[model samples]
Target: MTPSLTEAVAQAWPPAEWRDVHLLAAVSGGADSVALLRALHKLKREAGGRGRLLVAHFDHGIRGVASADDARWVAELAEGLGLECRLGVAAGPPPASEQHARDARYRWLAETAGEVGARHIATGHTADDQTETILYRLLRGSGLAGLAGVPPHRPLTAACDVVRPLLEVTRAEVEQHLRALDQPYRTDATNAEPTYARNRMRNELLPALRLEFGEGVDAAIRRAGQQAGEAQQVVGELAARLAGEARIDGSPDEVRLSPALLAAAPPLVAREACKLAWRSAGWPEQSMGAEQWQRLYTLLCDAGTAGLQLPGGVDARWVDSIVVLRRTSAD
Candidate 1:
């Protein structure tokens, strides 16, 4: 028998000790999500008043009728289970980029959670996704923060926290569970296409890796992610402290960093502190890249660089020992 997702979630969640907790299960009509919804339904049935279980789905408008079909299938599933279902459809042509689609999906999920007064949004991110994510981040030359693959839970919006109960469960296990239950799920044809990096990784790279490295790759990577999270905690604490120390009097749109303070911190600390300052100044987290980090780091370490240009039309320059970050004129 497959271990229960509800059991796993019961152990890690109820983010607060509220008696009645509302959860919005994000379903995409895929095997993993179908299994998750079933498991949540089981949990909800076993323990009444553990709050309500709701379903949310978003159509990216990319796969045309198929995407709409997924939304309908999810709605039917929710109806069959007697749960409220919320649907969000992208109005315009869907963005071609995966990240854009993901962003829109998450925003919709968060927004739906808020509307339903749910405190948490649950997703079907399994260990296979975790392995793929860490490998992808590794291939992308991501630092520890990015390498901290698929967090088990994190705040999505002010009102909702996204929880991944299946982070330790494999996709194979999810498929197996669905099969055992005689569950039907929609398959996205794009998943098998080689055009997408994740598809290539899942279809080709992972199998090749398994052949070379053996079946323990998933376990090893899971351990690595856990260790990375522990490590990130320390780094995050340091970054927070450094961000406080580096902050100087400035307008909300501007963040002034003490160059000497930043330079004195460890290299990683300095980099994260710069990111902290950048975020404090109301810039998006993804706005910074390697070049942006290097530019900011150089500005801190060198102290003589004329100015640093960042993504999102942001700029940074030094006034003696103080580093100032401000929105670009165009912004």
Candidate 2:
């Protein structure tokens, strides 16, 4: 039997975390997001109603006028729920990359949240998304951190938190809840197109996996990601503590690490220490992937290797008992 709306909302843990927090729901008019909006709206009417729920939509400008229509649809959906709706649109056509589009969407959401006094920006990222992300990262040879998949909550900006309330709920449960409500949701035509890798995975591989591994495959994958996420949290804490042990030797623009301490450190600790120095030297964190980090760490450990050039114009070199890093003239 399909789960009820109450059952679906029960998995959303935000209300327990903060009282009187304003939430801005990101609705794309899809079933997942629609269910999120409706559930939150219902919860808003209950006793000790944790906070007010508002709606926000972003038009990527890649889908021609259909994207704009989507914004209108979400606004109307909010109206139906007796909530306020806010819309943001990209200035130009969305960049060719999915990452660019995602970045644009969140950047706008963060900015909107700042303007509207919302404490949390909520999206409809479900357990299925966590599964897909873990699988995708595994295919591309990601490390433990990457395998952790989508986090339930993260800092979107200094003032706002990006939260995924449905991470414990499956896509099947979301559709089932919507069915129980007899609600209407619009489908994005682009989801069927296989140009994107994620679309291909969803359209092709996931079904094959289900067939071969049985229906529990999705749940299993999500569990694996959750375990990885938990393990990564421990690693992050260790990394932070290791970063503290590193000897800071220069200004923020040019950071130097103590070679003697790094060489004496364990491999993992040393890598994290180099990462700390790299950040201190003004390197973009996202630009350093797992392999890139491993390579830099290997270089830091080997006396034979002298220097390394990383993305974002950052350069690192060994100088006797210290390693120095500086940003160069490169984009």
Candidate 3:
């Protein structure tokens, strides 16, 4: 007999004491989320736990009826499972884009979890989501950080940990678990719509690749992400060493690298040092395109005196003996 979802989750958290741990489950009333709730509840009961299980549902208010229905369904499911439920509506002015909406949702979730003193906030991100994220980042020319896809645990703050126990499971497995448990879930019609970038990747890009190339394209990309993640760790270490060697100051917001030191370092280390410098100056990750990176590389290698002002008021200047990166005061 195969291990139940509860067993799998328990195995993942084997070292966890499981007592008095407030687990906040982000439930959208979808099959995946519902399955996560059930599995967590089972684990809580089996451990003879003293902790509280809270369900948080956010209504993005995109679809009129469907959005409300999802929140209602999640509340009902939480009640049925004997878990406390909190419902939050995105009531302020709508965000500018879907990406913004998602960011707001996670921010709200993190804030709520902190308010409730929850130690762990669980999200239902399956292997399929991870695979899609990897492919999307790759297509956007993201380096190691993006290729790492989603991490299993992210420290939301000093207090809370954003955990994804379902990272190893696939969407189909979650649906199967829901079916086995006779759990009812709502499917968002918007997920099928190809307007979103992620939806386009899922529906159009991945399918085409699978049909044209072979099956397991998703797995292949995921494997690549794992390898890239490891390689990125190595590169990050080397970059840190180079930063130390080239440093005139330690403040992340303003970095000054010794041009002589940079010139002596390996090419990859030099490139990553520049990336680190830009990141320290508040530039968004992957904001620099390949051409931009190449141009910056050329500037770093050849020019004795050059400066490039980037978007977001960031500017990189190469003086006589040092490369300086700072955010411009101008808005």
Candidate 4:
């Protein structure tokens, strides 16, 4: 037998000493989210006036009838549960790009929560999702930050906090709870498609791994992510301290960094120092890649009075005692 949704929530988020916090739950009329709603409702009641709950649904408008139907189902469910429901419609089809859609969805959620005076946004991300994320990042050779996977709580915006209460619950348990309660949910057809990397990993890679490695693959990956998260936090703090020590400030178009200080720091610290300089010079993070880093480092150390032009109309020049990074007007 599987644990009830309430039992799962209690295990994942212990109620003891939990303070009152305004929460906005994101529901997609899926089994996982519906189960989360039920569990949170029960927790709220048991807490005896601990916090307020709000339901938010987004219609991506991908499937003509199915999308609207999902929005309607979520709204009706929220109504029956006696929770305030906030509905939003995506102006058009969410971009084919997964990262773009994710960014847009979170932006919509953050905006809605802010408008409704909600302090936190709660998402229904299960342990399965966390495991998949960790595996994907590992396969992609992601840095320590990517290895951290999804955090339980983080600031979504300056005003709103994002919380994941179902991080420890498996999809099987969520489905069982919803089925036992006779609740219906909408399944997105696209989830079954193999074109997307995540879907391919979920449907193909994971099953093969499970068949060969046994059933503990997900748990092992999650543990690795937890350890990586801790290590990344420590590294980030050290990098920030080193950045402060090597501070060189200038206009957004022009950034200056001390060559001697950068050369003296560890390779990781040097890379982070250069990343900070690029960001301060108004260059986005993704714009700097391995080759670009190599060019910048070479210019800073070997070739004085020389500059390299980066993609995005940015230029890095070594002059006097500092390397200056500037964005060209054409960028």
Candidate 5:
């Protein structure tokens, strides 16, 4: 049997576990978020709250009046529930792209949460979102880690985490809960726009696939994502250990590794370790693709004579059986 919205939320994050933490819910006046906020409020009431509930909304102004309306609706909704609301409006015109808008929203959420002393930020990402994310990453040739889709929780800062209480709940369930409560929500027309690939996928591709293969397609994909997540956890732990063990010498701008130690590990492990190294040095990885990582892995394993330059002004070369990755002046 499909779980009710409240049951789903409780299953994902029990009141007993989080009733004492200051949580900021990221609500965009959509059905999923509205349901999430309402369900959490109900749980808190039942748990006899020891903590505070905060609502946060970021208006990107992409739709001008509609965008502002969303922020207003979220604030009003929070106010009705007697919860504090934090509203952030983009300083300039709306962001140029969807990615930029998402980035801005998150940055604002983090900042707002810090100001309000929230230890966690909860979002309304549902199971359908997870399936869409997994399919999108698959289409882009993402690796296993990418195929794992959206995580249930992740650290946004040292003291704060972003949690998705509806990760296992379906959008249909959210709408059902909202309908039961006679709650209203804002619908973003941009979600139906054809210009966005995700919109196209959600409207056309997934629906068409479901028609051909039945509803089980979504379940199968979600299962694959769950399996991928489990596998990635194991791989991540090994990579972290390998990265730690192989590091022999390092400075502020450079990291040195034992080529023999790296070569001893599996290719995938070594490659992931290299990624960890890049992150530790604060090097930009926006342009590093599968091919670039593979090249670095090969160089590390083979001790190639030719030195190669990487993105973010990093250079990789083999020196006396040691792999030295240094930040150069040139990109």
Candidate 6:
């Protein structure tokens, strides 16, 4: 049997240790987020905890009146729960795309968490979201890291982390919990607009897949993600060691690599090491695709290619047996 919302939250993230820590709940007035806020509030109250519970809502300003309504509704909900609420609005028009909107929301969340001194910025990412993310990345030809899917907890900032306490809960469970409480939530019409690739997948592709393959498809994909995550963890450990050995004395803006060392390691580990080096140097990876990583790997291992230019002004060249990567300009 599926666990209750509170049971799922407790099982996924026990609240005993975190009861006294300040939490910033990202409530968008949607069913999932509203359910999350309610569940956390219930858990905290039941634990008789002295922890501060805060609510954050970011309005993308995409839907005009509807967006404003969401913000107001969330504030009211927070007040009803006797929690402090912080509301943020986009400075200008809606972002150009869904990704841009997401970026803006997260930037705001991080800032909010910092200003409020919150330890955890909790979000309402459920199992459905994870499944969607896995499918999305798989369609994009993602590497093992991307295929591993969304993590339950990640750093929003050095001092604050993004947590999903309801990751194990399904959408159906969220709605059922709300129904039992006689609670209402705002719905975004954009979710059904069909213009966004995610919506299209959720509405058309995923349903068709489920119809064709049954519920077992979701289980299979989730299993693959679990296996991929385990594999990536091993790869990350090996790559960290490889990166340590391959990195030459360098400036923060520049990373020098020993091609001999990289060439000696397995291709997968070597490529991951190169990526780690790039990330450690704070180079731009938004534009770096699998093809670019492959090209960099080839340049590092093959003797034919002397040098290569990479995204975010990173210049890689072979100087003797060393591969030098330097950021020539700011991204």
Per-residue lDDT for 1-331 in model 5, tens only? 2238888899899888888878899988888888899988888888866778899988877788888878888899999999999999888875777777788888898999899888889999888888899999898788898899989989998878899999888888888878888889987723211237887888899999999999999989999999999988898899999999998777888889887888889888888899998898888888888899998888887865589888778889988979899999646
Best candidate (score: TM-score): 5
Worst 10 residues of 3 by lDDT: 187-196
Query: Which candidate, 1 or 2, would have the higher TM-score against the true structure?
Result: 2
- Candidate 1 versus the native: TM-score? 0.85
Q: Which pairs in model 5 have colliding backbones?
A: none
**Model 2 Cα lDDT, one tens digit per residue, 1-331:** 4346555565566456644878899888898888887877766666345567789988887888887788788888899888999998888765667777778888899999988889998888888878888899888777776789988889988899988888887888888888888888887723221237887798799999999999999989888888988977776677677677665757767777666666777777677777776776556888887677787777667767868888878887887766677787557
Q: In model 3, where do residues sit more than 4 Å from their true spots?
A: 15-19, 189-195, 250-254, 281-288, 303-318, 326-331
Q: Give all TM-scores, in the order shown.
A: 0.85, 0.87, 0.87, 0.88, 0.92, 0.90
Q: Is 1 or 3 the stronger prediction by TM-score?
A: 3
Q: What C-alpha lDDT values do all the predictions have? A: 0.80, 0.77, 0.77, 0.77, 0.85, 0.86
- The reply for model 5, stretches above 4 Å from the true place, is 1-3, 189-195, 250-252
Question: Which residue pairs in candidate 2 collide?
Answer: none
User: Over all chains combined, what TM-score does candidate 5 have?
Assistant: 0.92
Better of 1 and 5 by TM-score: 5
Off by over 4 Å in 4: 1-8, 11-19, 93-96, 180-182, 188-195, 298-306
lDDT of 4 by residue, 1-331 (tens): 3346687687667655343767798988777788888888778777855667889987767677887888888899999999999998877656676566567778899999888888878788888889998888888878677888999889989989887889888888888787887777776623211237888898899999999999998899899999999987776676677767666877656777787887777766676677765665556767667777777767766655467888778777776777777777555
Better of 1 and 3 by lDDT: 1
- lDDT (C-alpha) at residue 325 in model 3: 67
Query: What are the candidates' C-alpha RMSDs?
Result: 3.2, 2.9, 3.0, 2.9, 2.4, 2.7
